[model samples]
Target: MLRYVINRIIVALPVLFGVLVVTFFLIRLIPGDP
Candidate 1:
């Protein structure tokens, strides 16, 4: 259903944001810039 899809997307947004933040920090921690 449309509502289910919307709910899933809402839930995934935070997880996606978390992943982006973690990745950004991890990349910054690398010894050399890419």
Candidate 2:
């Protein structure tokens, strides 16, 4: 059970990180705020 949860988390982490990276780039491209 714990291992399953950990595995799921490991898979999710990259997806979440990717979303964050994409959002960051989109904000930077659109806002160009400093």
Candidate 3:
């Protein structure tokens, strides 16, 4: 159970980072919105 939780967290971290990066760029590209 502990190992599973750890693995999930590790996987989630990258996905979260990717989402943040995409959102950041998307916000910039749209312009006139923030």
lDDT of each: 0.95, 0.95, 0.94
lDDT of candidate 3 over 1-34, digit per residue (tens): 9999999999999999999999999888886743
Mind sharing the TM-score for model 3?
0.87
Candidate 1 regions with alpha-carbon error over 4 angstroms: none
Q: Residue-wise lDDT of candidate 2 within 1-34, one digit each (tens)?
A: 9999999999999999999999999988895647
Instruction: Put down candidate 1 lDDT per residue, 1-34, tens digits, no spaces.
Output: 9999999999999999999999999888887855
TM for every model, in the order presented, reads 0.84, 0.79, 0.87
Which run of 10 residues does model 2 get worst, by summed lDDT?
A: 25-34
**Which one wins on TM-score?**
3
User: Model 2: residues >4 Å from true position, as ranges?
Assistant: 32-34
- Clash count list over all predictions: 0, 0, 0
- CA lDDT of 7 in candidate 1? 100
